[model samples]
Target: MDVDTEINELGISNTVDEIHGAHRIGQFERLKTSHTGRETLKRLGYHLHDTMHATTHEIPDWISRALKAPIPKNMNPTLHYGRRLDRCLNI
Candidate 1:
């Protein structure tokens, strides 16, 4: 699917969709706008986004980590997601 469609379906912010190409949207519940919520979203988003271009070694590591993590019930959008995208890619 296209970025816009994926963004809409995943409930990501338009700003995140703006990152364009090679990205997966991560969402959190709007009601849980606390530190924990943001942190969890960041980790999930980093994992999802990294999948688009992860190297062979990186892919397995990320997948393993994500598989061990719990699925959150909320669906909220945050502005800092993109800002941390680079850090995730570097990991």
Candidate 2:
């Protein structure tokens, strides 16, 4: 049978449609405007991420330490994501 037929006939328990259907539009922008909500998210300039990139290594020591230390919340962002695009997405 074709993929669509297989999905229709045998995919009932897997819920592929429901998996993709849960996303809402403006999901990222959905944060309510509190002092620390959308406004803080928007203000995020990836400062830490930039700082990480400006260093000599592909990844830095402090970031590795983050696993053990939990990158301090007060650290500067120009430092870059101790991550890939996490700063832009969830900073």
Candidate 3:
């Protein structure tokens, strides 16, 4: 018998399908705008930063640690906003 026939006879196809279905469901659930998604990303070492804002007073400590460069103490709001807009437009 060929490889496909052997896989079918052993029910490996069904097992593989089930695994893919489970993975898809897990991915969908994790993409929601909820704490579960945030926590999952955090566990994977992805820290969120408020790149849209110029003020640094409210930045979380975790963000500082995650960044390679030191977070600026203060930034010009207009410059920050312009940069954000440029990034969005380019993307």
Candidate 4:
């Protein structure tokens, strides 16, 4: 696929859709414990509710490994947010 096509496939548009309001950002501050983590997980658990949908969950086993690896303290927020959101889709 060409670069433009790939970018579109990844859902990166030069502009956000005007029909949508502000994008919601989840801060983990409220998820202080595993109980809270599980509660937060519940909100997303529906992503896999339908087996007849033909789409399967894509779990990245490398995430825990990747997150545990060392990294520079100074990281780009854009890349950080991308990986963080990608991980949520799996969990």
Each model's TM-score? 0.18, 0.21, 0.26, 0.16
lDDT of 2 by residue, 1-91 (tens): 8887887787565465565555432443343323345445557541222222222446778887776756677565656656546756785
Candidate 2: which stretches are off by over 4 Å?
Answer: 2-5, 8-26, 44-91
lDDT, candidates in the order shown: 0.53, 0.52, 0.69, 0.54
Error of 2 at 62 (Å): 54
lDDT of 2 at 67: 62
Residue lDDT tens for model 1, 1-91: 8978888888666564476432432233441345565556666663324433324445677778777655454423354677567767989
User: What is candidate 3's CA lDDT for residue 16?
Assistant: 75
* lDDT of model 3 at position 30: 60
* Per-residue lDDT of candidate 3, residues 8-90 (tens digit): 89875677778899997787556444656766666877665544223437779999788797556655456679787888899
Worst-scoring 10-residue span by lDDT in model 4? 46-55
Q: Which pairs in model 3 have colliding backbones? A: none
Q: Any idea what lDDT model 3 has?
A: 0.69
Best by lDDT: 3
Between candidates 2 and 3, the one scoring higher on TM-score is 3
Preferred candidate (lDDT higher): 2 or 4: 4
Candidate 4 has an lDDT of 0.54
